[model samples]
Target: MEEIFENRGLGLGLSFSGLNGIVTYYDYNLDDNQQLHYSLELTGQQVGNSFKALRLTEESTDMQSISKSGSGNSLEIDRILVSGTYRWFVDESLVWGISEGLFYGAGGGFGYSTLKYQGERYKYGSQHIR
Candidate 1:
């Protein structure tokens, strides 16, 4: 388990606040040759914006499999993430924001640092404000 805290500021003044937590665990049964896995993740953020916007999300998944030894096995996965609206400050306590924005991200994973899997994933998402 782990926890994190972060903040962003400009010119000696705080501008944003953020926090997150993560948990992970794995279990194996020697007698039955079964395996179990678990994970949890969550995050929250606050940005300086006039619209006062907030977002929250959560996800969970479960899987069960039979081992080669004829034993039952189970696996579980979960994740949570949240992001707040970006705030553009025109003045003290005054903010500005656009109705729309663009986002781009990329990620990849390899097997044992040998580039065997060569799997890659990318995501692009946008949000609108009223």
Candidate 2:
């Protein structure tokens, strides 16, 4: 179970600290609440300290080759996603002190990600000389 979390978080460009960090989103209502809702999303997370993706153990094999391969540096990545939404309320009614509402919405988000790292990188069968 823990490995599942680590893999998911790392895949999303996050360190261990980020996993423990609080993840929250904010929403805002426009001047008029009936017809529309607009929100400016500002979300980000940063690791306070440095960490290594691949951990080494005393019984690990080929540690020398692995150490010599990857450069000694921390990798940093930044991702920005901007989006907007438009929703229409079909109907709303109060039942048993609960508000029952029907809404239709269409929204999309575009994400631009940038990576900055000074180390060896590779993909597929190719190996980066640098």
Candidate 3:
């Protein structure tokens, strides 16, 4: 503990930031009694962080030394999404405007999504720890 008391240097830093977005959608009427709706979405993200330090230290033996250390990390990600829906009207005509009350037949829907990820860590310089 006496040797550690001879060195007096400390440093700390932290930062975080990000940006994300992306998508599209569409709807079509196959007929007066049939409707088809579909949509597509895409997204990509990248992030990085780094830490570095340089300092001077002294020992109880009356000796002086220089210390250098550094570390870093990085990441990348990509994603995709697709979806679709189909609706049918059995009653055909039962409205005068709004299209939410004509659904009376069986319908089918489907969706698909995918994601890709990559990451890496790096270190530089060197230091001797007590």
Candidate 4:
């Protein structure tokens, strides 16, 4: 048998993280020009096999992609992670912006994550900006 799980964290943006759950995080502008920001987020879920995800291999098995499923009442595997993000304004006020980030220090009993911000629309023009 197969099963899937999902959950949302209470915060300002959409985050997805899991060995079996979803989570997201966000940060907003701190200055008028909005050229600088503290934005951050997390995404994706942890599933299948932990060994393959962590690139772990035993002497008996050559290194390879890991995928597996099981029948049980526990998905006790933990896919914990932490990430950071920084954003800059293509246009000021953070109305029009671009961001880049990295996710490091993630490991076995862990999974990959991606971050994104929603609910804000970009506004254009110099003086007309807010």
Report the number of the highest-TM-score candidate: 2
In the predicted model 4, the residue pairs found to clash are 15-23, 15-24, 16-23, 17-23, 18-46, 78-109, 79-110
Off by over 4 Å in 1: 1-20, 26-33, 45-130
TM-score of each: 0.17, 0.37, 0.33, 0.28
lDDT of 1 by residue, 1-130 (tens): 6855323221211222232223233322222222222323232211112113222222221111111122322322222432222222233233335523222223232211111111233369899999
What is the lDDT of every predicted structure here?
A: 0.25, 0.38, 0.40, 0.33
| Positional deviation of residue 46's Cα in model 2 after best superposition, in angstroms | 8.4
Sliding window of 10 residues with minimal summed lDDT for model 1 = 60-69
lDDT of 4 by residue, 11-57 (tens): 54433222223344544444422322222322222422333354443
Clashing pairs in 3: none
How far off is residue 30 in model 4, in Å? 1.5
- lDDT-best of 1 and 2: 2
In model 2, where do residues sit more than 4 Å from their true spots? 1-35, 38-72, 94-102, 121-130
Supply candidate 1's per-residue lDDT for 11: 22
Q: How much lDDT does candidate 4 score?
A: 0.33
TM-score of 1: 0.17
Candidate 4 regions with alpha-carbon error over 4 angstroms: 1-20, 32-76, 92-130
Weakest 10 consecutive residues, lDDT, candidate 4? 100-109
Give the alpha carbon lDDT tens digit for every residue of 1-130 in model 3.
3533211222222222121324455657676566665655443331111111211212221111111123322233444456666767665355557764567544344544333323343458798999
At residue 19, what lDDT does model 3 achieve? 19
